[model samples]
Target: MNSIRANPQAGLDIHMLDVQFIRDNLEAVKANCKNRNVTADVDRVVALDEQRRQILQQQQVHQHRQNEISKLIPKEKDKDKKQALIQEGRDLREKVAALENQVKEVEAELKTVLMTIPNMSHPDAPVGLTPADNKVISKVGEPKKFDFKPKDHVALAEALDIVDFEAGSSVAGQKFYFLKNEAVLLELALVQYAFGKLLEKGYTPIITPDVAKVDVLEGIGFMPRGPETQIYSLANTDLCLIATAEITLGGMHRDRIFDELDLPIKYVGMSHCFRTEAGAPGRDTRGLYRVHQFTKVEMFVFCTPDQSDGLHQELLAIEESIFQGLGLPYHVIDTCTGDLGGPAYRKFDIETWMPARGEAGEYGEVTSTSNCTDFQSRRLGIRFKSTKQKGTRFVHTLNGTAVAVSRALVAILENYQQADGSVVIPEALKRWVGRDVISRKGGISG
Candidate 1:
């Protein structure tokens, strides 16, 4: 339809704490909310949950009375008595309907409140509110000390004639760009290299849709249609351009039940990601560093709860290995509880060396891996069946960035810039990019 869309939702699908869990462990949930820096009305949710149960009980009572009256209506020999019983049954039916509606109202409100509670932080995760409190897990590959002045990626790219923000901004808007010459080749090579790496690690590679239904975005805990939302939603439509492949990949098994044999399903997804950049740090509208759109190679996994912790580490390890292969100076950060998003039970970030991030060189986030234990699965209704278990259990979900191509470009362009204004391609991606260096007059396009 060419018509304008209507009533797009501006709220988040965040806050998926278990109601029964909260009922049993109210203090713990409350404490977790405080640690995570979110408002969780634990007391109010508990109160409403209690009321919800009471309404259910009342419904049952009404239904039971209706059933009895229905039976009496058929059996009564006196016509007048039979008619009276029928009227009673009708009244009971109406009362039961009213009780059901009231119960729905209570449950809806309870659920809304309960959604404010986030996943509990991993006990090993540091307790803090921001990146400043994040603990450094490890630093890999020492930063190269240049004898000559090092040029930032922006300047190097311009000199090499590989990236054009001038053309991009004119056509689209700021933070959008055209990757020209070797830069374009480098982007493709990064994708191919990352895909090959994940394939070697036994992942099935796929290219996900750049757009997904709004509900799918919510299921993955990506709040859409908000002024502060990173997600870019289509107006009057049911879809939004994805900020990450995670939204589509995480929702793949939504409302599905997997058998125990398929206990682990790991996918390597590549997609062109779009974001409003509304959540960009410090409102900084700079280079490809804060872009409106970019290509990403992401890894997503659906596994049994017992398997997710190991998988989480494996994902992070893969991310670390990728940057290491590129020879970028980087470090692993154990994300603090308060900084962990609503869906993340535990998270780790990899920050790579950026020679010209600010006034001086600093580490900036390049990749993130999260173990969203049953948070997405519960809301998405993705579960697994075990013969040993009588009922299904929600699967644990995990996502890791394999290569955020734009940032990888940033690291490469800056880190590999020769004193002569040339940039050497990462050895691992050379074959696919078909080049060893991007230099002025390098014999490709001008």
Candidate 2:
């Protein structure tokens, strides 16, 4: 792998939280950052922005003077006078160059500080510091009561010889595994089942690339190259293995402008997601709960500001429906402000009941939907123009997980496990899986 180093700053044109918006709403932006637990120098951003503007004004003034001197030099009949004008023009040019450099330096610093400021939290979103503070919106379905001691997905998969972690480790490394026999069918079935549901909802189905450029990832609010980054950068390239279909789906229409009539565009994308799982030490390391790679069905939408809130709810509803179709017990959570990260104005998560998670069972996050509200669109330059309106406005971006195959599998195997060491396939997936049950003998039965 030839490692070619590219300038990390070359494509980072992030225009997050318009500088003017921050300048005008300084208190509000500061409070938002405090609530989000983000440590950004809001005051420094304002100062730097002011410096940049002043330098730009100076540059403009010098350029204007330089142009005036150039005109005078060409018309001057006296050689000494013309030479004086030319010298003045050269001096102005140097000053303009110096001011331009200052503007760039100031703007770069401003952008860096601005990147640390998170999106404003929705008014209704709970203000908290931890997941424990997240508000539970609703719980759907009841966890099944197993007569026999329930086994985790790892044990269940081993007993059925359906997943080969050893082979995967030998070929790849830790946090890697291969689905064999019915598990393979189950993964394909889950993808088909989720895609079918999304299609009915009028979403355009797409299979996206597994990798994307670093700029694309940054535009989508992912820190692609950092100590705490979850993304996997390819050796010697600007490309990175996508952590989710969200990156590719959102990057698909980068710099695109839509007509008002095409206000809302929805896509259900399938792709293999890769993550380094960095900084997450000793948490959900067992089985497939937290892994290096997995296939996922992701939903992404680009819409106007007015449409984003409603579309966000619709995304949540769709996620609920998908899990419901699987007969999985789960609950919806209104994610707290501190947990919203850098882009999401508001977010909702669905935690599916995993019977083998703890001493008995616990709910594990299986899906999430967020309303980014122009945060990503501004960075990616995705905008829309209305016939009634004059200029283009940044489109709001939203994304949700229809299915994370690995976590879904963990939930399915544990929840649907039978006393006889058999796993029952959800009715929604039976058509694609070609079976209702998976037994130890690798036999499928009705």
Quick one: RMSD of model 2? Answer: 4.3
Candidate number of the best lDDT: 2
Over the full model, what C-alpha lDDT does candidate 2 score relative to the true structure?
0.89
Per TM-score, the best of the predicted structures is 2
For model 1, the run of ten residues with the poorest summed lDDT: 1-10
Model 1 per-residue lDDT tens digits across residues 1-446: 00011111222222266667787888888888898889878899889877877877787777778878877776789999888888888888888778777876776687677666788778898999877889999999887888887888888989989999999999998889999999889999999989999999999999999999987887788778545888887888999999999999998778788997887999999999998877566654667787989999999999999999999999999999899988899999999999998899999999998887776788988999999998888778788999999988889999999999998899999999888999888899899878788889895743
Q: Against the hidden true structure, what lDDT does model 1 obtain?
A: 0.85
> Model 2: per-residue lDDT, tens digit, 17-103?
887789999999999988888898999988987787677777777877887887777789999988888888888878877776676
Model 2 off-target regions past 4 Å? 1-14, 67-84, 443-446
lDDT of each: 0.85, 0.89
Q: Residue 424 in candidate 2 has what lDDT?
A: 92
Clashing pairs in 1: 5-236, 6-236, 15-115
Q: What is model 1's C-alpha RMSD?
A: 5.0
